[model samples]
Target chain A: MGFFTKLLETSRVKSPWIVHFDCGSCNGCDIEILACLTPIYDVERFGILNIGNPKHADILIVSGTVNHRNAKVLRNVYDQMPEPRAVIAIGACGTSGGIFREAYNVVGGVDKVIPVDVYVPGCPAKPEAIIDGVVLALGKLKEQRTAKDTDSLAAELHQAREFYANRADRQVVE
Target chain B: MSTIIPFGPQHPVLPEPLHLKITLKDEIVTDAIPMLGYVHRGLETLVSIKDLDQMVQVVERVCGICSCIHAHTYCMCVEGILGIEIPKRAEFLRIIWSELHRMHSHLLWLGLLADAFGMESLFMHCWRIRERVMDVMEATAGNRVIISINKVGGVRRDLSPDQLRWIAQVLDELERELDAIKPVLTNDYTVKKRTVGVGVLTKEQAYELGAVGPTLRGSGVAQDVRMTGYGAYKFIDFEPVVEKDGDSYARTMVRFRELYQAIDIVRQLIRKLPDGELSVKVKAAKPEGEIVCRSEQPRGELLYYVKGNGSKFLERVRIRTPTFANVPPLLAMLPGIEMADVPVVALSIDPCISCTER
Candidate 1:
């Protein structure tokens, strides 16, 4: 790899901007995610910013259970992010739907729709655990960057697009 | 020509999924249609699956910010049906926890409002003070956000004498910190310029449209569900915090003052705490009547209608959240404001979309 390319990849790993999406959570995990940005937890000190746009984000932090209505939106957000991105599914709901799993509208966990690299477990995962999950996802992000060649990266992107395209119909069938 | 701009389902300003189709004429708004059901998880429908005793945990998840009040109101509804009067100590304990939840929730909203107006440092300070409340909750109730302390009869946990004293000390510290930030939130030129006279909800409009909580009180309505003296509110000495301006500034002042009011209420409950059993073991009597119970949440007045048919499961559990009642007022307030002020005005009601949708 070129020196500039290596530098960019290292920077992406060191300072990953995150976009947080609440898929049908009770707001427990959502508030905890916000708590991670406050002075006490201060995820920004590690160069992490909780940004709004998915395209500019290096990490996607999802909390809550996937439902039918928001599944398409979640997939759209994931597709918007660039390649070599990481996903951290926080809270019991995001990991495996938590208490709301049995609710009629719930579609289980975040992994049911999009690929997730880290699973942080708690009914509402603690801010500390969410921070840890983000750190773990960063390692996976670096691994994905090192492992994929340009050709392989293009192939993976195409596969992800196809998978997401078919996912809506698959959800309907289920 | 009017333009329809879709706001949210995913927006940085909103914490929950609340979409609004805002119709604007030039720079001013003409109409707004709210699109909900994004955060709906069919929680009320869980009444058929989970038994009445198990339903406490279910209802508590309705809104994470005001989880205790939801559980408390649910228990009160069931206790009314079964005619089981909880012990005095339990009532006081419930009051303490509920007040703490109120304090934390208002703090969270203050931080969000500051962030909405681009006062990033002010937002940080608001949240920094809120962490102490969260710490107190964690120390007393074992969880930070969703502290499930209420059961069917009374609270599941009791405060020891040492913990109570420690909480008192913490409240003193919280009051000092809140005082330090009070001037910036209330008297700051930027905050006033953005909030005062913006999204004015008149007294008649607020009352006729059924605005509740700070939204109602901010419009000079002295109505509060706490005045009904449910639980230990009868024993406590406090009045509803009211403002007369009926604008975003008024609403912000209502919640800001409420933070201090909640701290005061908690202190009173601690001082006048009556000694008794925490709860009474409920007899296995299926609730066979339909009843409605109401409680004051941090957002507004929350109503729960429960119907039982002499079975292990409730026939129906309908929740009328404060946000649902406040939405109409919010819609009414939107038409006259500029597009830039939409978020601040919408946030002034402290809309909890998850609670509304659930």
Candidate 2:
């Protein structure tokens, strides 16, 4: 790999900019996620910045459950982010839909619509846990960037395609 | 020429998902229509599956910022239907937790409002003070945001004397820190410039529009549901914070002043906390009637309606949150404002879309 490419890979882990999207959260996880940016947790000390633009983000941190209306928006956001991006599913709602799973308009977890690299599980998911989840996601992001060979890229595409195909079949059956 | 612009489903200033279809005529807002359902988890409909006791946890998730109040109001509704009175100590404890929640929520709003106006340092300072409240919550209730302590007959947890003393110490520090930032919030030139006279809602307009909480109180109306003497509010001296200007500044001041008021209420509740059981053992008597319960959340008045049919599961559970009432006033405040000031005016209502949609 070129020296410039190696520097880019190292910087992705060194300072990962994250964009948070609230799919259908109770605001508990959303606030906790916000708390990570505050003085107490201070996730920025790790060079992590929470920006709003998905295109400028290296990690997509999503909270709450994925509902019907926001599912499309969530996919749109994920699609907008440049490649080698990582997604962290936050809280009980984002990981497995928590208590609101039985609701009619609910679409369960974030993985129902897009891929997730790390899962942070808590009713609200404390700020510490959220920070840890983001850190873990950065590692996955580094691995993703490194494993960009043709064979690995093709494998990831096939896995993602199969995952969506199975989801479509499940939806049809349901 | 007029053009309609969609102002979010994902905006940096908004902490929750709220979309406003704003119509602009030469940089001035002519009209604004709100679009919701982005965060609707259909929590109210879960009454069919979860039992009455189990519903408390579900109700708490309606809005994470005001989770305790939602659960407290729901429990109050169920208790009213069942004709069960909670213990005095539990009532006081509930008051303490509710006020703590209020303080943190207001601080969170202040930070968000500051962030909205691009005052990043003030935003950080507000949240810095707020961490003390979250720590107290974690130390006492075992959770930061959603401290699920409320139950049907009473509360699930109890506060020890030492814990009470620690909370008092934190409140003292909180007040000191609040005073430090008081001038910047109330008298700072930039804050007033952005907020003052930006979104003026008349007293009549606020009342007629059914605006509740700070939105209504900010408009010179002294209508607070807490005055009806629900929970331990009757046992303690309390007054609603009001501002007459009815602008974004007025609403901001109302919430800002409420932080001090909440600290005072918590102090009073701690002093008068009665020694009794945390919760009563509720019998197998199922609630068999419809009842409405109301409480003052940080945003404003929260109302819960519960119906029971002599079964484990409730017949229906409905919640009318303060944000739901504040939206019309928000729409009213949006017209005639500059496009640049939309974030400040929109955030003044402290819109909780999850609660509004749920």
TM-score: which candidate is best?
1
True contacts kept of each: 0.57, 0.67
> Across residues B1-358, which tens digit of lDDT does each residue of candidate 1 receive?
7777777888898877788988888889988999888888998888889998889998999989999999999999999998999999999999899999999999999999999999999899989999999999998999999999999888889899999999999999999999999899778998999999999999999999999999999999999999999989999989999999999999999999999999999999999988889899986759989999999999999999999999989999999999999999999999989999999999999999889988
Candidate 2, CAPRI quality class derived from DockQ? acceptable
TM-score for chain B of each model, two decimals: 0.99, 0.99
Candidate 1, B-chain TM: 0.99
TM-score of chain A of 1: 0.86
DockQ of every candidate structure: 0.38, 0.37
How large is the interface RMSD of each prediction?
8.0, 9.5
Q: How close is candidate 1 to the true structure, as a TM-score?
A: 0.95
- Model 1, residue A171: C-alpha shift (Å): 29
Q: Whole-model lDDT for model 1 versus the true structure? A: 0.91
Give me candidate 2's TM-score against the actual structure: 0.95
